[model samples]
Target: MVKLKIGILGFGYWGKKIYQALRRIPECEITVVCDKRKIPLDNKKIILTDNYKDLLRMNLDGIIIATPNETHFSLAFQFLLKGYNLFVEKPLATSFKEAEKLINLAAKRNLNLFTGHILLYHPLIDTIKKILENKKNLELKIKRTNKVSQINKSEKEIIYDLFPHDIALLLYFFKKEPKIKEIALEKSLVEAHFLIDNEIKISGVWGKGTDKERTITFFVENKKIVFDGLLSVLKLKENGNEKIIKSIDYQLPLSWELSYFLNSLKNKRIKEKIPTLKVMAVLDKIEKLL
Candidate 1:
């Protein structure tokens, strides 16, 4: 078996999880781990570096950019130029232009570039997509929150940090980009209401809260299904009866997403354009509402 030599940038929160997931795959080997802050690795086999340029010189098949939002475009562009398949953490880039450039690079070189939209890999989201495929009656409500307002200090606006996960799911189930009906913005919080194909209502709130809640709810024809991260279970309702998809799987979503990207890298067919630009475009519109 040919092990893929993988380099990961950013050893922060999600970056650490990516490291753990990649280690579980027998076909993967962590070539180097880079971050602004020094990170201690238990595996002495993996080289740790603070300078990302050091990674460019390493022999690696692909690099995963798990850095901050503002740094995503530059880091991804750099590695892509060096001829490595890229797994970029979500919200692709801060702007549509940056996203377009990355996509174009991938197209020109035939290298695979994947956005880290972990929610799309959720089994619950997959089941929901099948149930709501092209259905205009569905209503989506998503909220991603922190316990306090001052906690997050990343360069990304709270909306960009959180909403892409929900938006990816929205685009999948609705099969179209929903029009923004209204947007309410604050310094660190945002509420955007969207109408999908002039039918479904999808509303999202991304920001801090006095209480913590990360939930996605879908309503259709007197029935609703909710995947609640807070409760760690999926709730379903229909015909006056209720069912629970008790205790979501323990497997890491990043692992599944990486596995898919690695396997799909060999297939040359481009079914549709990468959705990074679209995600950035929607984010742009939401930012304008601020």
Candidate 2:
């Protein structure tokens, strides 16, 4: 088996997860890593650098940009231009222009490019999608809240940091862009409400300076599926009886995503794996809302 050389940038919360997960894959080798601050690594063979350009110089099979929202386009652009396969974290680009440009550029160069919409790869979500495909009169409601963290310091609002996960999963399930018919923005507070498809509602709040709650509820006929994001479990109710599902604590999904990207890279067919242009357009609208 040919091991692909993988380089990771950003080295923050999600970055570290990607780095650690990729390191365990037998078909993968962490060639280099970069971040704004010094971070310890399990393997000394992994070259750590503050300047991304330096790591970019190392001959690698792929590069994963888990950096800030602002630097996504530039770094990915340079790497893609050099014909390196890319695995970018969610909200592929902060702007539509950049997202569209990168999507097209990856196609023109025939390079593997995947957006890290991790939720879409979850086993429960996959099950939910399959169930939805066979059910009618299904109503989905999702609510998520994050703990008080410095990550939301982007000054972009909770929607940018939080909504993309739900939005991408919503689009993945709907398999088409739903018209965001109603939007209710709360003022003088830390929470906002949005109504998409006129049936589903998403309300969120952060920066409360206290404990947080993250949950998502899906209503289909007589069954209710509630997802506890913080606890990583699913609560199900049927005929007045309820059951709880505990999520497996593992990095299998992330590994699966990376493996898919590697296969796409070898097959030279990653452009199709990206969110459709229409989905990108809808996300652009939500980006503006943020």
Candidate 3:
């Protein structure tokens, strides 16, 4: 079998993880890597460029975009229009219109378009979802806070950048859009709070002079499962008794997601994968409320 040549755009914080994972995949070869600014060389094998158009000249099977939220639509548009398979980072795009455009284009081209919703690949999260399925009723609370960034961003709120993970997870586990009964939002240039789904509430703060604190809690019939994201541990409680659930110390999520994508590309159609149009539609609704 011929190995698929993979090109990654935006070799920034999260992109490096996906780049590393692509290197590890035996079926895919990391032929090109591009970033807007100069990045230090991680491996000599990676052909680095500042311009993404340079990548199109090379024979490429797929492209992964880990750039800023705003660039997702335009960059993906360029590549998917050329008929290359794509792995786009979360939220699909900054808006529902762009997401739908990308989806429709990918479908028309009969190419794979996978979202980088890495949480969907987390085994521990999947376990929690299974446990919640057996319960009668539940409410979820997701708290995500991080220290302020030195970099300036246009989409300068936590809701747009961070809450997508929670939104994607809620849609995945609940399997339907819950009536967003009410929303309480406190907005600033950097931070925001969104209380969504009458039962499920999410509080988010992202800006300067803050330490990282991420926690997700699920409350249900006689049970509670709290996810401490920073610590990467889950605390489980049943009937008011609490115990910590150990997460399987695993490799990075992008690697798992890429591996899954590889298998899906080989064995299943792109539409069959998680975070398909169905999932993106739910995200569109959540984006509106955000």
Model 3 C-alpha RMSD to native: 3.3
- Each prediction's RMSD over C-alphas, in Å, is 2.4, 2.9, 3.3
Ranked by lDDT, the better of candidates 1 and 3 is: 1
Question: TM-score order of candidates, best first?
Answer: 1, 2, 3
Candidate 3: lDDT over CA atoms? 0.71
lDDT of 2 by residue, 1-290 (tens): 88888889899988988877886778888889999898787678888899988966789888899998778889889998888888888767777788889989988997878888777666777766776775555566655554455334443445445666776776777755566654544331244455555555555443323346656688877788887665657778899998975475557678777777777767767643327455567657755654
What local lDDT score does residue 50 receive in model 2, on the 0 to 100 scale?
93
Identify the candidate with maximal TM-score.
1
**Per-residue lDDT value at 137 in model 3:** 41
lDDT of 1 by residue, 224-278 (tens): 8888865657888888888995566546556778787666654633232237677
Off by over 4 Å in 3: 148-157, 187-210, 238-242, 272-290
Q: Which one wins by TM-score: 2 or 3? A: 2
Q: Give TM-scores for every candidate, taking all chains together and pairing residue i with residue i.
A: 0.91, 0.87, 0.85
- Name the runs in model 1 displaced over 4 angstroms: 149-156, 230-232, 238-242, 266-274
What's the CA error at residue 109 for candidate 3, in Å?
0.6
Error of 3 at 275 (Å): 4.1
Local error of candidate 2 at residue 173 (angstroms): 1.1
How much lDDT does candidate 1 score? Answer: 0.78
